[model samples]
Target: MGEDYNPEKEDVYLMYYDVNNLYGWAMAQYLPYGGFEWADAKDYLTLPEDSEYGYILEVDLEYPESLHDSHKDLPLCPSTPAHRARNSAKTPDHAEDQT
Candidate 1:
């Protein structure tokens, strides 16, 4: 969906904001506990992002390189954490002590 997005362009500007409490902030939010019921997708689609209800959606996504340029500054979707083995290839962050 990179209609006119181009990260390689000279005039493009980027900014990074450090969200110190992003997960912590969301953890502190108010969430519904019960009374969840199935609703039609069409009806649920009409709800705004900041709607007063919580939802769990099953969506299929198509992420392409062109779309990366459009969303390079920020992600278009939230990342679902991947499960990996602790003994897998290690970057410095995960490397064992060299001592």
Candidate 2:
């Protein structure tokens, strides 16, 4: 805010969603149990639609430099907890904020 900034003279827009029991609905989905096994490429490639064999897929990706100029302040996606943040000296999400 500048020296001439005024709260009453300005319009502050607050956008929000009114979702009830959203977390509870998501938690009601089927969850994995027991031990997990390393599946081969073929097993995952021809996985059945109803199967939760490869429910999650983590990709080692690089954010494009072309878009960095506009989206630098925002995190595009949730990063893996084990790997370090791209081009940062800070540790992964397990400890502290990458910022």
> If scored against the real structure, what TM-score would every candidate get?
0.42, 0.42
Instruction: For candidate 1, report its TM-score.
Output: 0.42
lDDT of 2 by residue, 1-99 (tens): 789878778355554767799889879876778677765445456777667654565557888878864654555864556555454544567456635
- RMSD of model 2 against the true structure: 9.2
Q: Per-residue CA lDDT of candidate 1, range 1-99, in tens?
A: 377977667555669797698899899787889999987666776778677886887788888878876677788885745654544557876555653
Candidate 1's C-alpha runs over 4 A off are 1-14, 18-30, 37-40, 48-53, 85-99
TM-score computed on alpha carbons, candidate 2: 0.42
lDDT of 2 at 23: 89
- Scored against the true structure, residue 95 in model 1 reaches a CA lDDT of 54
